[model samples]
Target: MQLFNSRLLRERMQRFSFPAGGEFKKKINVIAKWQKSLRDSDLSKTKEISIQGLFLSKFFGEVLGYTTQADGKKEWNLTQHPGNDIDARIPDGSLGFYSSDKSATKAVIELKDAMTSLDRRQSARRENFTPIEQSYLYATKYDGCNWIIVSNIREIRLYNKSKTQSYYESFNVLQLEEDEQFKRFYFLMSKDNLLGDGALSPLDELLQTSEAQEKSISGDFYSAYRELRLKLFKHLRENNVGYDSSILLEKAQKLLDRVVFILFCEDKGLLPREILKRAFERGVSSFLDSDQRVWLEMKGLFKAIDRGNDKVSPPINGYDGGLFAYDGLLDSLRIGDAIWKEIVELAGYDFESDLNVNILGHIFEQSISDLEQLRSEFDGLELHTSRANRKKQGIFYTPENITHYIVENTLGRYLEEHPDRLPVIRILDPACGSGAFLNQAHTYLQKAWKSAYEQGEIKSKDARYGTLFDYNPAENDRTILLNNLYGVDLNEESVEITKLSLWLKTARSDEPLENLDRNVRCGDSLVQSREIAGEKAFEYRKEFGKVFEEGGFDIVIGNPPYVRQELLSPELKEYCSLNFETYSGVADLYVYFIEKGLALLREGGYLSFIVSNKFLRANYGKKLTGYIQKNYTLVELMDFGDLQVFEDATTYPCIITIKKTIPEGPMTFKYLRLETLEVADLRAELEEKGYEVTITPDSGGWS
Candidate 1:
């Protein structure tokens, strides 16, 4: 019944040695009386006005260091008051803090009646006018306001206005008074924290703490994935399967990826919850001493998952079969019941609760070691080592931050200027190894569609934009994903993995997957067979004819392979020399991808690539540089000189954004010198001096 437990408040007061002055002490005592009055009231409801007057006013004035007029002692006062609609109709109340040179409203407070909880979802009728929405609206309107507080006496939510979404932190007032560790929460909303330009200091601290917590969580998740894979491999080996050590390793890696996907599906409610647990229990009882029987049962389950429920004896309605196409391999392999049980138990973690696809992608990335590391460990084993070698040959995956930045400035900015094209804009990743850029593009499209939907810009659920926001794959999500995202990779396995990753991204309960082959192809992007072999020769154009015939894509982005000239096959080397104007004897392979990507872009289409920075200064880059200056409008150039973008690698990476259009005059290219590895620092610098440099490309070089 107490507003805050009296003893806990007293302890906090003494521990922090908070102002024990006469007026503050009296104000605190008065707050306790108001709590008693609210608690003892016979009325079924307490209005918002009473809550504001009795509790919020005293708390802000005395505890949080805000000026207030004394009861029966004040004349006309000009100082701002923490009350409802203080210069804004949206927020319930706002507080203004002043400095010597400036005075501005620093925070907005949204209050509800004692009976109303701010955390609960409102009824459909009132959903649009929820407290959280109101707080966000007010914060957005006020240029100086950086904080939003929503409270219903019992629970309090604090949001940082600077975030994309203003939902940041929350707390229980009573719990804060009781726990000493919770005292840090005060730093977020304290008067001292809001002074001058230091308001965001506390938010920065919170971000650091949150980042540390995330890293710890990611480490744990990685360890779990690693342990599970090793155990699964050991079990398979013990069973004496026909495959040799090398084959076993490859199969083991694929099986581990499938198991992870299965776990993810279950967590996301695509599969029945605890389905793995039940399967394990049943196997233990039915196949008690028979390892072969357990393996057979597991094989059947995989087959069912692959063919989906419609084709199986006992259908699992929602699954798509491509991921489990290697069911024959599973049937041949024998796994012990105990091993099955351990794996099932491991999959039972609540992955869907806090983990998103982005985080899961990171976890999956850590599950497998690079080819070079793996080859060193398994000596004399003839593993499928070409993929690993390719990775080492500068086919590194792009980091999410870099991907997002490029996509935002290119496709994102394009869409903003041409809103009507959101539904039809086509995106391509020519050398999509694992579909990182494509996945990011899909995510961006989803967000854009969601925003459009919320703003009532799009009306029908059947609209092309609807596919982006549809969570259920049976709906339009899969269609939108397939129609919008196109990719090509040289490695077939990489193509399959890219398809799988994209499927995982848009997967929902009970949705059948459309054939992804049409969108994601496997071929060498640079050289067509006809170009090398003459008429009737093999060509990638025949495979990806649809995109080629359509006059190219609306957006093309990727981190292309960076093989050296010496590493290129004789046919490819000759083909590049004959066809590409930018080809030089010492030019790296990525240079060709750049020319290919440009060729595949329609006029005014955007193209972005994170490739070797050597093209900026190398002797062989003169042709490429000249070609770019003559043909494309260079939108941005982010040079990471000597800063390694890939982990444990030593290549200087640069991100270049260009539009497939000619420039009329000296174009101001947004250039950033990446002095640090941190993306945040780069972003901050980009905001300040990104457009400081300008250049016009002549036939020779940049001027």
Candidate 2:
């Protein structure tokens, strides 16, 4: 319970109203007596079942307000999940919903002795699920159940779970004497709220408020992030001399990237908790200046990250990737007291729990976008993620849902199509921004291989096989970056962030990070061979010789950058015309990505991209559409007309999944036109409501 599973639960706990007035004091007095009895007595030595009787039942009946059987017991009939096979009895108790005597039990409750932790396995088996996990499984499957209560007689926790999300709140019994602790526990679990009318209750109202609050809180991460980014920039700007503003921004970007990498590592336990903070504290304990402490610590920790710490008894291996490679500028700079302190604080932010991968990717993308803006306006007061800015640039970040959907339709299907347990396939994201699509693809592959191995579907333990991409607690970051995934981004920092993210995702304590320079490259994907306007080209045949030799990648996917047709440079347009038959003079920058992505795919290889839907009817999109229709198999087309799938942006986007195979008959494809306005559960919506349609790609304006 110390680790919050979701932002909704965090918000709910923070905002739960503390009960007040005279009546609340009386309830507190009763709770105090129970607390004293449990602690003052020898209740800690008894069996866990004793908790169901002694003080817990009384607390539930008198304070929380749940109905009990005639014998003062709660119901406990629950079936064990197949995967959670263990010799354990049904749940300890099932409480009536909304205090309704007529209704069946709709909430499951588990009890444990004061000595047992909530995470203790109920059975002696090592594979047995923990009590909290067991409770969640049973609660989700139990007829009509929406909530679960787990307690070790010393602390109580409530969980609300759905298929894709989980939320919960925990309160300690020892803190009951305090008004804030007691009130939140009482109000949220009290019979008056849980057993309220079938209509909206206090809990329901709180759910609504928390949902809105979650969005606001998410925005707060960026606000805090922007502040951190700007502060670091200002510090570097002040410290560095004889350098252009763009160089200052680049230095700032590098500094922030390292901080973000370490924060993520700390979150995942690859590094010690408060590593930077400890460094800062070490400076304080040594009576060093603020300017000296942060730089000294950050440099040391980063060095250790690059080269393992061998000073300790059990040496921790240093990461091998070029992320922490020597930077002459950073080495020479010394941050002042105020900026360094602020940075240490920001570094301590809980990146794992609060900023999930998708949000983290957005933070990176938006940070880079904003940082690029800062490059032009070094002294400008404003950084823009404004919708107007996005509209003008035709820029929209591909949300996780869209990325997951595209990956599934493309990469997921590719796996299913091949019966071999683990196929020798590589995935490429030609226009990879923050590597969101590549990250998702890698995650899917990891799970698929892990599940297969667990189910005994794969027998070989080959290092170069499934074991490479699969999670090997010891293998760490090296395997995932070997050859399975590839990325190409124009921005060098984007390439750096992509590697950092993948490394962080697969990082383990004391493991060396892999070098992914060849796998995830940085160059102009549109200009493959010769330079176009002095831009370095990521030539597929020369760069990925083996991939091209074996036809091409098994799957190519990404949300290519969107620049309006008018913005394409003259040289870029010339390159596209010379190299791509699908190119058009008025087509946007993304059009070239689609063409290049497909070109990188072998026959029957899958391709998916979520780009602007203007291509459906825009005059410039005719050649691209016709080329797709004539040369490839159109698998799916999801047209989200006018509905902004992004969080706070205005744009029309469509996901098109294609296969690099010549079509023989009618071009049939799965078609989905979003009918709903909400972005939640998009995969579910597409599956339940999407239908199929035939298309003539040669015709004008495919729509």
Candidate 3:
């Protein structure tokens, strides 16, 4: 039977109008009444099952326009075991819609109680035990069934069994009352939309394409960088350049990164686009076919970028000489006609077309990883063996999801609490390998500034410490970038990459990056030269003195290096143990970083880090844990116990958030034990529960 008459359905939708402000309130009032009655019913667990059937099933069926079985006959047998009893594993209900000639089963849906939510642990309870998996199993068992849905009244998820990932879409039913969200809901579940393509709806196709585009951009950028690196390395080797392989790799990467930034600037309209392209083309032309000419042409281009707007070339505002000032860098770098042509071709790709700062950052990350791998092979070390060495140094980039969660909780929460301090808020990532945290913070601040401007909460003059003037979003972004966002890394290459990434994040088509070194620096953060009281100590102090003299950073965040004491140099290990109260004989370098981050925060400021969860119970962590308890307010802890947040990594990681001030009384903090990486859902659950526990100095260890 046809569940919905197409003609009538179309007419109904055409006549329907969304509710206005009062009308929307009225709808919510009606839902509130139903909720009150349901609570007053005092239903048991068994009775709640009936509510899922009587209310949820019927409501969704009517809304989505699906025909349901009336006699309670199972539409498909999913499990291998055969049983007729309801308790012996039966699908919730089967849905059918009219195809061209006849009614056909379109999807199978499984429902759970409104209070129950699906998580990875529940899914892994048994093979195909979760609602989504159960529906998937049924789809595989039955012909012509391609859609599977799992809902618990509160949240709904749809899956296409034929797809590799299977996951299609998910939405909270409670959110359907919102106008925009309601539109999304209707597009995904409307009878017309679903029946048009049972396997993948139009909305699904759009989402899939967006995801694919992001991946494509990242992949293409990496491919271009890889090609340039290989060609440049081959050219240098052929020319018998005396630099070691490590030095060669570093120089090549630096040159490649600079070229990419110039290309990006060109695409964003900051530079004359065709000027660099044409210059390279002329260098490789048959008339100037000598490899030496290519080097000279490239050197001229670099000189033009550094000097900006000379007598011969137009002024490129905001161009800095720091990035291009290496002694003999241009003189030593020479490329053949073929390599020059290939590099130019790679540069021709559009860098400003829907390319985001985060994606660009990931491209750099992958490029850096590849460079390290190549360096390891050049050193005669096995690839995997070299990777393990790097991991020990805590060189891995933080995954985007974890970074997003940490930033939202720490920096996002801080800004929310103190809106007036937006312009002056200083954020620092001391061990900022490639500046992932810094870049994310810069993006977040820009968005926050724009939002405040739109709301008329900020003005141009108001940004001048205390005065209120006309609001300019672009100026506000520039201010945020220049005044805020600080980072330091021991690796000079990482420091440069961080600056480049941050510059890329805030680059405007009309402006050039004039002074990126003001905020990001290269230094060892933990030990100051003065504190060491030796010849080496003075050098350390000179490097870090200015960073500390600025009244410390207002906010500090990073995934600090995880080297153990055994891996550290004798001098460094002795210094850390003597300087940091948290440092013990066997403490890891990350522990000292935690101490340093805390010391750097201003009074009442915040610090957050993702490090080994071993601090909770390890013997070496006792001093650190005690220091935190006595000095700061523990804001939140998310322990991903044995959950591999980083694929193939051995350590059990946890996120720690703390405020710089001491607690006046019993302090309650949010704690989570995550078994999977469904961070969005985990965050929702945490918010709903508001889990808090009071810890005191008298209380025993965290275990």
Candidate 4:
């Protein structure tokens, strides 16, 4: 099982043995000391800076020098007072430094050792700060200096203050180390990685220590606490559990009753700790808040503590033995069976052990002969689910038809001929919403695994391919699924749902199982950094590894998000320009994600995306088309022309597929021309079961 490190907040609470007030005080002190050091520093001179300049420096790091201007050249204007007399002034050593020649204040420099949290926020939230709002105030208050540069004691940023338009354009010089005999103040800002190691702060170390302790709470204790709390709350609402401290007595009575019943039936004893951990891991406490935790603890105390002796029972559950043993025992009981059934039904899976067949959606309907109870269970879910948006439906599945066609036309042909070679395929969906594309690809590979297992090419199925029934896939085949399917998305909720979707779909046709942190994960595909945990949490993956040198994904497929040009956040637009080499038409965020996805794949990785048709017909889309024409080989264009691909979605969407490395010739592209939203015949379909059909245009065409 994969263990996630405890977060900073939890760690602090654990170590402090209370709350965050004291720790926050310490953080404030540290900030003060850092600020004082900058004020006292002898290396540079300071001047009164505009609030906007201070905020900008705090955010983007202090500017050392301009690329175009000479040292100590103040070319820009930060003066709020229009006719203020500008002249030489002494540096105050807080906001930034003035030039030595002092002709025009070209740069602002603020010193620092480590970056503060507020430093980065300054770059983006320009309109929110108080000081920056009064750039004119700074100009009238002090003479000279148009810019401000603040450093995290390492990295420096240069901001050109443009208060008239209300923003600052800034750049980072990365890491700037302390030096002597510098040619000019600006030269010091030229280097990157100012300090070695970039070690974590003392506070960070303390936080990590606290996190280690929180996860150590035993399962039995947790479970007992939870049950008592839930019962107490239910009682409080219904007036049953009682109003006094005897709520504990009530919970104890309930547990004792269960114990009596169980003891009567069998010789086994119950451990509460093991039960609680299992519940947490299965997302049982997902909605529980701090109040609920306190209630549970209080209720557990009243029920479990021996009143006269004033002592709680010794916890019987151990992490591996007692905890897991309890889980195994529970799994055999009616309660466990019911819970597992619910999870299975929610994921929309169906598999037949006798026929060795697996179906994608609506599992219980075909598997179980009795449907009355299950139908009622589904009805309850509808009421619960009505509040959620489409992203929650688990219905935004990648149409399998598109997958089969893309894989066959690109990777399949090669795999079919080779036969013996394991397809060293690496597929990525930059905006892999709910792992739809990966799920489809994973299913295809599972079929391949079953085929290999049947052929007796391998032995011993991995836990991933294990089932409750007789069906199993070869170990090698399971590895194929594990290795080939990887996706990244920014939505935390979507990432969890997507992981569950992939896990449910990929499980052996007849099984109940679990996996800890596989290929699916939460992340911004564009802003991935090496600092982030998780294998798929790639920071700039397009720039490194086999994918960069050899090319990226073998099959890329998904419905990338369509963010409007007017709606693009300034930070997002700027981010795209800084990272992506080629982009089109303030082209949608989806377009940028697709371009990044394509570039990350191997030479011939096929990309199929359900994109907005605006790129096909809109004026901005023209530039996007021109870009695709120049870079990619348009292999298949399934244009869902005039289709309401999205009912609730505002954008008129289309599906297009292209290969990264297409051979020279008139490429054969398929066009799916839709006439209406309801017409099944109008939808295109590939030759695969459960794959939907839509209206399609001719297959062979020139770009």
Candidate that would win on lDDT: 2
lDDT of 3 at 420: 69
Candidate 4 Cα lDDT to native: 0.39
Error of 1 at 171 (Å): 15
Mark the regions of model 1 whose C-alpha exceeds 4 Å error after superposition: 1-207, 230-250, 287-289, 303-316, 353-355, 366-391, 460-476, 530-540, 565-571, 665-668, 681-687, 692-694, 697-703
Per-residue error for 241 in candidate 4, Å, reads 21
Higher-TM-score candidate among 1 and 2? 2
lDDT of each: 0.63, 0.68, 0.64, 0.39
CA shift of 510, model 4, Å: 12
Q: Mind giving the per-residue lDDT tens digits that candidate 1 earns over 1-703?
A: 1112223334444555334468545644654554555467632166665556545555565556555444333321113334442233456666664444545666778887656545332343121234554565566566666667787765567665544221255665545543342444454455554442455544445444555555666677766666666667666776865567655656666776677677877777776666566666666668355655555666666766766665533347546646677656655676666776657666745566434566666554433333234435554433343445645455665677677667666775577556767666778888887777887787767756655654456564545445343333244465456567888876554676677777778776666655687888777677667555444232545665675666768899988877767777777777789989998878999998899888888787899999988888889988888788778888878888898788656678898888988988876677777777643223334644465556665434432
TM-score to true structure, per model: 0.69, 0.72, 0.68, 0.41
Candidate 1 accuracy as lDDT: 0.63
lDDT of 4 at 152: 38
Q: For candidate 4, lDDT tens digit of each residue in 228-321?
A: 3333333333433223333332332233222222221121122232232243244434356432343343223323321211232433221111
Model 3 scores a TM of: 0.68
Task: Report the lDDT of model 3 for residue 354.
Answer: 38
